[model samples]
Target chain A: MELIIDRLTKQYKNKIAVDRISLTLNKGVYGLLGANGSGKTTLMRMLCGVLKPTSGEVKFNGIDVSQEEYRDSLGYLPQDFGYYPEFTAYEFLLYMASLKGLAKQSAKDKAKELLELVSLSDSAKKKIKTYSGGMKQRLGIAQAILNNPKILILDEPTAGLDPKERVRFRNLISQLGTDRIILLSTHIVSDIENIAGMILIMKDGQIVHKGGLDEIIKAIDGRVFECTVDAGEAGKLISMHTITNFRQENDKTFLRLICDKSPCENAISVKATLEDLYLYYFKEVNTDEKLF
Target chain B: MDNNIKRKLKSVFEAPMPAKKDDFLNQLDYPKASRLDFIKSQAGYIRKQVWVLSLLLFIGTLILMYYFEVSDSVIWILSSALPFISLVSIGEIFRSITYNMDELEMSCKHNFLEISLIRFGILGLANLAVLISLLILLAGKTDFGFFRLGLYLTTPYLLNCYGSIFAVNRLKNREIVYVCGVVTASVSILNALFTTQINDIYTDKYWSFWIISFIILAVFSYKEILKLIKKMEELKWSLSLTV
Candidate 1:
């Protein structure tokens, strides 16, 4: 199902959390990349009907979200998900399934199946309090998918995961997104770099960029460059260029920086990445306002 | 036989249902599952409070029985008060931990209507329990007139109980409820101590004063409840818009 968010805004007293922003999402994995407090979480919460918007509407296939029916196909994992500490992983998933209106036998069956899918079947009987951070995240993912929801919203789904578990979780989400609209919100760009079918970048409560991965990369097509400089000069180079990475070896520094055109004598042109585009847009937007 | 069991287990794990995207949208329109969904969702928290309150009440009952060295009359009081106190305290504790609408919105199965009803029902039952205990005490004296007085007092108790739960849920905070519970408990104890005088006053022309007071309190409570419900509806609407 398609999820459409139109002119959504959330205001808390004098501060605006989400400005009037609109976007339409189709079935696929979409990365919602933004800095912290950039309204990414607010937008996600609004989509799941957890937080009320100051104005505007969120709809699934033209059905307004305020209707309880719209929430049935929606699943969300908030950044700070609270679970009953005394419940076993199995029990917790079962409880979530019931909330989603699954039949008793179906909920039990789905809980067991999802536990296996997230690779937590071995510890399914263990209380949630005893779980490690990565394990809890895996359980969160499991519960989010227990109802086989059509629209899945996960906020920082890989925040505390180890590298290996992070990769596995991403793969699982990638598989799930083939038939559902998956909006993965994170401050970490790399989490969605390879998997996202579309990337929407948010800044100051507005979507600054939205398109496919290659299209976003194309936004800064000839901006990235790499060069070797003396170790002492590397700091000076960063002031003039968008230095993405720096490696020091044998008293020389290899710097991967970004500029509209080549800036150094020995600089080699390189293809732009999602990270380069994100930093470039955000940096440009910030600089235009004369704010460091 | 073991091999057959193992095969069955493997088959259970391997089975997949082809991921039928059933219409969750339609199901949301279905009648909400049960009022117990709220209690069940808060079961873990309720169990803890029940355990602690039950233990304390049990010990207090034993000590009172031993110290008074009275007949079945004393046992009767202990038996009545023990369960009533334990149940009310447990209900209060559950209400305290589970009143946050944000948390309930996240964890429970019911919609806002069902959730409010469950909260009101629990608080109502607790208040009813206290009223019943007072009635039983009057019965212990074989005073039907006093029993009738206690029954009459239930009208105010029920009104206050509903008002408190409604107020707490609308604010989505439990501190107010805690303060009210303490105040009401203290007042009830004081009232019980002066029951005979209060009953005498009720029989005289002062009965009209109590009736008028009850009417004023009920009106004020009704107004407060309506305001709270309006605020909650607004809150829910604004929240939906943001999403």
Candidate 2:
């Protein structure tokens, strides 16, 4: 299903969490990349029908979300999900399924299937209170997919996961994006770099950039440069270029830096990445291109 | 030419399939499900209270039988406790229902005010208990009737206590009000029950006191109900904006 978000706005007292942003999302993986407090979570919450916006309309396939029919095709995983401490993993899933109107036998079968899908089948009978953070996140993912929703919104789904689990979750999301509109929001740039069909960069409640992964990288084209300088000269290079990140070897400093195309003695060209683009957009400087 | 034929063949095989009907059962109307869920959840709490009160009354009946050496029939006393127990259970059930409704609103999910009239049903049972107790006393069986009245009075007091505890736990902002209301109402009922001078007053005066006490209790409980209703309204507004 396609989702249309029209002129969405959410103001908290004097601060605007989302400022009249609008976008149309179709069946693909859309990555919302921003720093913390950039309104990404608030936007996702509005889309999920959890937090109301000051002014906006969210419609799925031309159906308003206030109608029950829209909810039938929607799934959401909030950033901080609460669960009944007294319920076992299986029981909790069953309860949620019951709320969704699934019959007892089918809910049971779906609960077991989801637990296996999230690799939590062994802990299905265990109380949720005893689960680790990663396990709880996996369970949250399982619940979001229970109904095979058409529009899925997941906020920071892989925040606390280990490297292996993170890879597994990303792969799962990639597979899910084939027939559904999956919107994944996170501050981690690398998480969405490889999978997002389009990347939306937000800052101060406004989308600063929207394009494919290669386009975002291309924004910083010819600006990324690497150079090895003696420790004494490193300080000068740092002041001249936007130092995105750096590595050091004995007696020399290697820097991944961004600067307009210009003569730099011994500086070599390197490919820009999503992280480099993120730093370019979020870094604070007096230059016109500096995001902050 | 070969590519065009291959594309045509792919289109023939890949035409969208016809839509399938939902295999799952249709969702029950939320209002209907909410009412049923409320009743089912209350049944558990009410059942527990009935068991406790029944046990207490059964023991009391046996003790009275032994002390008075009255063997006309023990069935009457047992049967008398039945209506009283049911009345008390009804109050417990009402409290349970209100508690769940409050919880549903606090979580900002659904509305339940339409079902709130259920509370008056419990209040009616309170009135019935008092009427039965008065009838027994008028029949000239002072001892049995007074004891039954005491049991009947305990129902409302305990229900108020349970309701206050539930309100305090569920609505954090109004805990003090709920607690004070429960304590004051229970104290008034207890005082009416034990005071000899109060008992000697006219029957109309006694009934008026009970009526006034309940009215005050209802008024206090209604404040919390209003708070719950306001919260539900806010949630609904929020849902609309977000959706």
DockQ of 1: 0.19
Separate DockQ for every predicted complex = 0.19, 0.10
**What lDDT tens digits, residue by residue, belong to model 2 across residues B1-243?**
699998999988886765542322222222123446543332332334555665676567557756765422332344333445534543443342322223221211221232233333544454455445444533343443554454434435544544553454364331345344544455444444444334443244466665565566556656765665564434433432221
When only the first chain is scored, the TM-scores of the models are 0.94, 0.94
- Give fnat, all candidates: 0.10, 0.03
**Candidate 1 stretches greater than 4 Å from native:** A284-292, B1-109, B122-130, B133-148, B151-217, B220-232, B235-243
Where in model 2 is the C-alpha error above 4 Å?
A236-241, A285-292, B1-209, B236-243
Q: What docking class should model 1 receive? A: incorrect
Provide the DockQ value for model 2: 0.10
* TM-score per candidate, chains pooled: 0.76, 0.69
Q: Candidate 1: which pairs clash?
A: A46-B243, A51-B239, A52-B238, A52-B239, A52-B240, A52-B242, A53-B239, A53-B241, A53-B242
Q: Which ten residues in a row have the lowest lDDT in candidate 1 chain A?
A: A283-292
Report the C-alpha lDDT of model 1 over A1-292, residue by residue, as the tens digit.
6788899998888888889998889989999998666888888877877666889999998888867677667777867665655689998887676667666677777788889988999999999889999898888888777667778989899988998988898888887888789999886788889678999998888998889888888877888999998866788888887767889878888999888887678989998888887777677654665564
What C-alpha lDDT, on a 0 to 100 scale, does residue B26 get in candidate 1?
26
How high is the lDDT of residue B64 in model 2? Answer: 70
